[model samples]
Target chain A: MNSNTRPVADPRPAFVENPEQADQQQALGRRIITDGIRTVFLVGCGGSLAAYGPSVYTLDNRVPQLVVQAMNSDEFNYRKPAGLGPTSIVLVGSHTGTTAETVRAIDTAKAAGAESVVSLTSDPESPLATHADLAFTDRPTKWAWDPKEIAMARITQGILDAAGLAASGFDEALAALPADIPNVFADLDPALHRIAEDLATKPVTYALGSGPMEGMARAFAMFYMQEMLWRHAAAYNAGEFLHGPFEMTESQAPYLVLCGEDATRPMTDRALGFLNRYSEHVHVIDSREFRLAGVPDGVRAEIAPIVMSAVTTRLAQHLEAVLDHDLSTRRYMFSVEY
Target chain B: MNSNTRPVADPRPAFVENPEQADQQQALGRRIITDGIRTVFLVGCGGSLAAYGPSVYTLDNRVPQLVVQAMNSDEFNYRKPAGLGPTSIVLVGSHTGTTAETVRAIDTAKAAGAESVVSLTSDPESPLATHADLAFTDRPTKWAWDPKEIAMARITQGILDAAGLAASGFDEALAALPADIPNVFADLDPALHRIAEDLATKPVTYALGSGPMEGMARAFAMFYMQEMLWRHAAAYNAGEFLHGPFEMTESQAPYLVLCGEDATRPMTDRALGFLNRYSEHVHVIDSREFRLAGVPDGVRAEIAPIVMSAVTTRLAQHLEAVLDHDLSTRRYMFSVEY
Candidate 1:
């Protein structure tokens, strides 16, 4: 099922053809947004919730009528919000939908006066999905280990759409995703393979970005270095590199900066320029190089980075497997009960 | 002046008596809030900003009218927020009020049409305070190395007051802060010192929290472990521990949880309970144990954590210093150019 030599064409096949998953995701989105809930709290772990950082930024900035918080599911039930009434919505994200923390979160939300609950997952029968008022599944690819990013993006867009906000641009971006992602895989495969090979030899690697991309960089660092490669990796903001992390940048340890769109570009350039002065170890992945497969008109410019980051990350994962590193050993995993 | 053995009644004498510094911080706060500003953006570094997290949470939940972002000042200016107009107010924080990033942030906010800027600092003529429309200084006690917590709490309350909301509760909370904080220091000081000693010997340490306290956990882990101890300290949601970081928790490198007052307290307790089952190395800080020195009536229960967390952190810093750490080291300082 896993091949190191063959180039993976697309990693989302399991989700694309699975009708059950699609229905679940849509249902979850609808229940949370259209159910007359005053507040929506989304919970997940690692990439599961980190994937929603862009959406969190968007909702906080654009949606004044709705209050949204993206938190780890384990924390949801334990540190429950004070004012969550019966009209509140709680959404949990778990790729397996069986994560104990996520399940507990759903239960806690239900107990707290949350009138509606939704789950975004890859498994319809998972404990979390089974307990939710509605469930959205983005079929988990058997060959791929994690599908939380795609599931989250789809569900987050659905939530926005259900809230009466047009998500046509998001839909268009996602539509283009399947086709556009292959190109990134093609362009990044060799570089990723090279990095993976080198990662085996190096002690640490730094993943850096600015703005919303900081979360993406962190996800990559956590998923690839900590989980897949079982190596030590650090995530830093592009502007913060000079503050202290820059000292660690020598001929030995290198850094990768995810220079995605607009405001982050300049910071990326500046960091790259500064690092170039010290050593030739800094690498940048510019967002402009990739075309937005297809985005709707009037889509906020800020939203593009959300979709693009997911694509960049998926490609980075392939690099991890190609290097023949362990893909399941996580350095830090939060227990759901806590 | 530097007596390791002496039990000083007040460690923050420099701050209390420095009228010049007080004038600077007050001026900064006033300038940013009242300078015909349509929106206010707050920026700070790790400790300086962590001190302000609760206030940011309170302001966001209560005011919602003013835009507040707990961002690194460097990132704020370089990666400006979309839709920022000429009447925006930019507020920057620094212990010295002269951090390079804060200086650049103030300049950037001004360039982007900030009607007025404010600085919270310990130094009256520090670059950040000097450049502001007004600056507010907390009494320069050594214990109050980073007074931004009080400064932010007051400023946020002032904004609420100006916006026609009653701020007496917030003001009363601030008044009670001085009294309640000492007990936290007395209670946690010995434990933190011992932990610092243990951490100083270890290769890494991890700080964990959930909900609004998540930001505080990150700030503490980064500053204490990364900046002070120079050890690899990671911060994560209590829920995320099981997803990945838990894999690394052996009998050796353990995790620390900063349990703040929030909905996730039960979860944190459960997580701590579970972690104890696995390893005896886990440490927990229940923030509510310390009495708030001057809490006023009508103050929302949610706002208590913000002030309490601030007090807890000041105590943390004293321990960090005893561990032979200072953030002012050359590697930690970055030049600000705007």
Candidate 2:
């Protein structure tokens, strides 16, 4: 069993060193501004696309001069938005640089005369990288935070800086982010174990988050719980929870709320409050608990999604241990052709 | 029990006659283009906000010059995107025109110097309407398609017409849409009854859709199943289903696929194909079954969501009957304050 499956008293997150790479991340954003790109499409399949959620949300709020959207790679290719040519930039991601749909999306973007097609992938020789105008490749990591999200943030920072809307201390905070992520696993080990024990045998579990944290919540419920552990799970935007899904509160299903420090935290809190009163199985995985060390308070909320992503990953691992399910076991994913 | 609860041999959907109203719907869209409103914010709470999903998707694909977004009312009020200024327009909705968050959002929009704030609600004297610079109030309808969606469409049409990207026969299609919605109820009753009978006792259910049909899929799972029927349910974008949630296919949970006739239909088909193979509990609710008379084939896919919304609403009533659950029965919605 992996160390993640077995809790240590003084558990330290296993660290995988991200190899030093050329700083090609910011080139996409810089080129976007230089080429007068009016629209930016962040496209990828599954979790690869999810990696850009927070960055897209932040860009939508911070840089109005640039219209930024995160779309599923398959849908983007099929619909092909009217704004996708000449003055547009398409940023896509795939860990192995071999997601077929994403590769097709990049090819289609290039064919449509998009000003730039940028890819973030681990394999420099992969089609996604070779087919794009520019590519940012790094060593693959287990968790999505390091190479993928960090590269996404850097490109985002470039856009904000170019538009004179850069968040103060954002660069330093992001640079220090990877080093601090492990600390979250160590700190939350005890809490995660307890929560996982409670939820292990539950037939269904839910993850909830709002604003920038929504993508991570979905990754936790759908990817980590359902996909990895083969458990029935789902995620909801905390803002929309009360509108419908909260009616299941009396079902006693375990609920985990990713309470980030962003402005949408209150939306999370409201749903949390309702769930807390109505159901006993409620866990709040707040970003405030993370030891981000020197990250400024002003930018703390901005990066909360990254920290919270680590927390969910650890929690999923704990659940795997308690449930005695192998994380890599799947019935149909790579086993069957659709 | 309502006729919806007990399937009629020839189920005719109950129609509430909508009174004739002013043609003020297109005014907002016209002003937006004339005043150079570059950003459009469609804001509302719960299902109110969901009603704008297809319109927003269509606009996003059709109008590159306009940045359009559908945001939860509370989150919109809190984050108040940096783009909310004299060049922006905010369109909000609330059934009773008193959704506190939506009203406050309009107030905040005005305070931020947004070019205009338009309110679409059923109450002309409501705060959401009274606080806005322009109000399009209509008689409330049982289904969201009539007054709410039609008004939303008219404004979208106005924008498209004004921007010179108008879909031919769109106005005629929308005007004729409400009259043909009941035909979907008559056509789908038998299929829905079989599906509901199979799903009535299932502990969990899922609804899947892609692109323009996504919002209705969500409404089916979250609003119809979870809230109204008090069933454990969730909705997923068909495009993203393969990424993670498809792992639950082996569980044999009841699956409902909202197959719209849009470009994204293939994405839904891919998931439906897998689900049909692995899970016996699968139902396909195709929008093509809806007879939208006089609507041209060119715009049929565009209006698929509106038709599917009616189908899901009718199916929910059937579930309510078979499950012996009152659609209005709720433990916390209006009973307790958060």
Best by TM-score: 2
Q: On residues A1-338, what C-alpha lDDT tens digit does candidate 1 reach at each position?
A: 13444453344432363545555665565666676665667788866787677766566544545556676666555556543558677778877777777888877887876787777777778887788877766554534423555555565666677767654666566556556656655666666556655555665677788776777788777765665555566687776655545544556656777776655567677777777666566666666665555654455345455545655455556555555444554444432333
Q: Kindly list the per-residue Cα lDDT of model 2 for residues A14-88, writing each as its tens digit.
A: 333343432455555666776788889999977788888888889887776788888999889988997899998
Per-model fnat list:
0.33, 0.80
The CAPRI class of candidate 2 is: medium
Error of 2 at B204 (Å): 1.0
Cα displacement (angstroms), candidate 1, residue B98, comes to 4.4
Residue B338 in model 2: lDDT: 79
Model 2 residue B299 CA deviation in Å: 1.9
Best by DockQ: 2
User: Model 1 over residues B228-281: C-alpha lDDT tens digits?
Assistant: 445565677666755655555566666677776655566567668767877767
Q: What RMSD does model 1 have? A: 6.1
Tens digit per residue, CA lDDT, model 2, B249-291: 8645788898988888899999988998888888898887777
